[model samples]
Target chain A: MNGYAGKILRVNLTTGTFTKEPTPADVARDFIGGRGFGIYFLLKEVPKGADPLGPENKLIISSGPISGMMIPGGGKCDWTTKAPLTGGYAGASMGGHFTAEMRYAGLDSIILEGISPKPVYLFIDNDRIELRDASGLWGKATFEVEKQFKEKLGEEYQIATIGPGGENMVSYACINHDYGRQAGRGGVGAVMGSKKVKAIVLHGTKSIPVADMQAYRKAGMALYKACKDAEGLKEWIRYGTTTVVDWCNQVGALPTRNFSAGSFEGAEGIYGKTMREKIVITDKGCFGCPSPCGKYSRSKKYNSYVEGPEYETIGLMGSNLGIDDIEVVAQANLLCDDLGIDTISAGNSIGWAMECYQKGIFTKKDTDGLDLKFGNVEAIFTLIGKIARKEGFGVLLGEGVKRASKKIGQGTEKFAIHVKGMEQSAYATHNATAMLLAYMTCDVGAHHNRSWAITYDLQVGRDLVVPEKVARVIWLQNFRPMFDVIGGCRLQWVELSIDRDLYVPALEAITGIHRSWEDLEKVGDRIWNMTRMFWARENDGFGREWDLPPARFYEDAPTTGATKGQITKLEDVNRLLDMYYEQRGWDSNGLPTLETIENLGLEAVVA
Target chain B: MTASIRLSDSLKNLLGSEGLFTIEAGHSVREAIVSLGINPDLVAVVSVGDEMQSKDYLIQEGDTVRLLAVIGGG
Candidate 1:
């Protein structure tokens, strides 16, 4: 009764029916929620090697107990599906009101199954669930579509919608919520589009029941006090991730000019200090997050309200693609949000194309007469449109870097810097072996959120070949993502570095189930093993070979930047994996042994 | 002791000083903040450098500290 909404909303789009079933207590206890429920359902129900875009591929969006509670930054929702992009298990957690709304609506998860004959939108106002016609809303930008929906519906509803990129089934399409926030990776949006559902809206007025309201309130206030007390709180909010721009640039992680260099010459323009001075108008936040990382800005240069060119957008779309103008980057960020593509992958793919064009692999003939080169911001915008439209070379790029490179193999694969089909996230990992290991082993493919190890790499030796670093990455992989399982943001602990123990009382009070950090870590291990099993069963002979970093990080080092002559050797990579496998109690091939699975209680789910 | 404090964008207007300013020790961050002629209640946390510390931390000589304010959030 505490921490759970007690039911799940299952929408079979193929039948145009919405059904609510009481959430099984066993599943709640075993799987927890959010990513846990998602992975469990994905493994059990989705079936092995199912076509990711087909009706058999179900997309489960879920939240955990911590969501919507007054706890500091206790807002995250998990989007899990067999990835249309990677052809593997994908779970992307997002911020904003959707998770909180799910908690308030007395729903633990929203499971979308089968493809609809026509486009439709799922609308739920408390108990009233309906599928509405989505014909007119098919082509609008995510922001525009949401705006239109809010104008038609009321302010109370929160909309998670995709744009033309998703409708077109772009491999890296992301579902956009709260204007800027996203479940952004591995084509979750593409899967939704395949199912012919454009948006899911939830609005509810029911009060969430807490087991111990007094303790919950006290713990929640204490979290706020801790956040309020963080020294970097104000400075951090001022620039958000942009604060790291100068530091990253200085450290040679800026991803300049299609990652040919790590440092950008024009990086100064996009510095946190510069953004604050030039255009950052206000600070924004995710649900219940006291430290607002969202930099909602007004481009006086462009005269428009854009959510941000957050560090990822600034790195991938800006410096990665060789666009230095912060205004341009902000505009690009807005376009990606509106278009519904994951900005990081989109930028990476475009950067790849630009490099190809410059290297004589492509010509004006291949690029639709547009000279696609690094630093051409206008060309970048045009190519983004073309990719969403799936026109010309954009069609090749739309398939994602892996497939594109495979298809255009003429040494082009040499520069395709993605791992497990998903484009690499913001950080350029040439020298940082720990961060490289983090990216390599990340569940969702090359995303940095699961284990942000660059600081660790910097703190320790950057290129040190040691078991401790491997153990650290594994520890982080198990720890950081547990928050997603609980449907909460980890930034309260990650960025603010709060006393993680402070959350124990709040969690216990809210859920009436006392789970210490160790208990939660066990759940995390369970989820990790389950997902690994899913990936192994779904793929042919899934082994250590599949769990590898990009060829560029090994075969080629940057010819420019701070890590100009650096590369992670093949021996070190194998060593890292060997250590990781040993530490995780997995077999030589990276498969979790039956004993480990049974210990984590994942045997039932996997078997 | 000449303890320097950096002001965030919003705090800049409230501080009435454009740049860093010197402060004394022995008092809590809240007390020293009030002594600097800024509202104590308005200040949120007492982060010494990179790490967030309690208000009781002694501001050592030439220590550049920050006093963050709570902003409106979701």
Candidate 2:
């Protein structure tokens, strides 16, 4: 295997034993790597109906063939497991130097199995791997843990650690790496915590083997050149993801006031330009990235240094909570990062709580003497810590908005703003039918990473429920996630608008396999179907009903903002799902038909 | 009649200017972009002041149009 390290490392915590096996060739050929490998193993190995936070649930962390290579934005890896959040399929893409280090260790995937009797961290320095005593590291914040490890083990080592959120097994806890980057969705970190593993430190010096060195070098150089030549490169590096704040606000897609509105009047205070001028100190890049999207900032007012209050955080924590101060958002971002909780989920959960407070569903008695009002900056800070530590009111929030709303009642579930228990990331899809459909059908709940079609919605008609909109969403879902499968970032092609074909030759040279976009999309389709089946198998009666967005999207129109008086009709939502199911070759109930499964060659795999 | 078009940094780089330019009113955003020798497809968002508009939106006199490059969002 030219592009691969050609090994899989399995560590059993209960037995305190580890083993390495050869990476299977057929699996690589069919599934590629990264997310592809993660799902393949999840379905093949993990038994059905296993408790997500129990011993049976395994965490599959994998890097793709292009990882650690000379390819631009090649630092991405995939973490797949049975989700404690959604209780369905959980796969998150993390970008940093961890995947590169994993490749240098001559490993593709590190599978953590069973539960450790005590807290431990997996330590790997080349071939010398051990389950080190992490009793001292347990319950520590992610930054402190990483700092301690880096100080003790030296700077070359890359460490991924969980904070109190994970230690407490918060449903939306995340694994933090490289200070700020995270495998930041679902409950992969909770599963790690459930297994009592606090962190994984890695350092490797091995050179990755490629199929054709000459061709590989040429393709790699061409990629770098294209990225450099891209018109958007400098601007993308400058603003990172924050550039979209104004655009999202303009388009009525910025999540505001717990998604009650699409735009915030205070949006100007947190726009990309404001972030750049006010807080951004450095433009940070992941491993081998040309156009780095990480905006590292230092908030003088808060006296905090954090990687991002990126667009998602700004939308979810800033506008969505009715707090527009970028500095406050940055502090909140730092708090979430240190606590090892997903900011999107934490902010969303807080937003729901605030909305609940505004509706008089709860009083100061419920909030424990704290004003749980929207834009209550002090309360926002307090709740983040409580959520991580699972203290007081935080206990209810730690369970996530979906579960919390279900428990709270009082018509709160209607405005919980989630799809399948995962909080909707930052996009307010009030009238954007395509983007809304994308959120509804995304494999990992309401995450936008799978398919971001809001621009397409603006390009076409935002409120149109035509088949073209549905088709666009489907095409994007299949095409965009190939980057995660290939173990690289899609921003170069996505943000820079570089020719995606540049990757074809690069992949061919590295993998020694000829795959066109069509071929790769076919594989993506297979993986997509496999994940859909995984969801169906894990949950009872999983179908179209489970895919529905919160009632607020169709029922409540924003009283203010750009999307005021605009709403997606409930019938249009169904129509979009109908077209989506038909195009995907699924039944009306949204289950993969037997013929569709056979067509994708997943008969034995699904069975 | 004239309207001002404010290009983002990326668009400014593409067009090689100070980023602020003048365009004739009554022309569609797509046509204005094409007139400036830039591909209409390259611009992902077009806004006039705080309002997002499609490329087909007719430019109005004294309107300050903002154009942003395609952002395959995170």
Interface RMSD of each: 12.5, 6.2
Q: What is the lDDT of residue A58 in candidate 1?
A: 96
Predicted candidate 2 versus true structure: per-residue lDDT over A1-607, tens digit per residue: 8889989999999999999999999999999999999999999999999999999999999999899999999999999999999999999999999999999999999999999999999999889999989999887999999999999999999999999999999999999999999999998889999999999999998887788999989999999999997654656777788878877776788999999998899998898878888998998999999989998999999898999988899999999999989999999999999999999999999999999999998788988777999999999999999999999999999998999999999899999999999999999998999989989999999999889887677666689989888888888888999999999999888777677899999999998998999999999999999999999999999999988998999999999988999999999999999999999999999999999999999999999
User: CAPRI band of model 2?
Assistant: acceptable
> How high is the TM-score of chain B in model 1?
0.74
Q: Candidate 1: misplaced stretches above 4 Å? A: B1-74
Which digits, one per residue and each the tens of the lDDT, describe model 1 over residues B1-74? 56787764334533445536677755566677777777643444455655544456778876777764422111
User: Residue A187: error of model 2 in Å?
Assistant: 1.1
Error of 1 at A587 (Å): 1.8
Each candidate's DockQ: 0.06, 0.23
lDDT of 1 by residue, A83-119 (tens): 9888888998889888888778888899999999999
Clashing pairs for model 2 are none
Identify the candidate with maximal DockQ.
2
What candidate 2 gets wrong by more than 4 Å, as runs, is B1-66
- A400, model 1: CA deviation in Å? 0.9
TM-score of each: 0.90, 0.93
Model 2: DockQ against the native?
A: 0.23
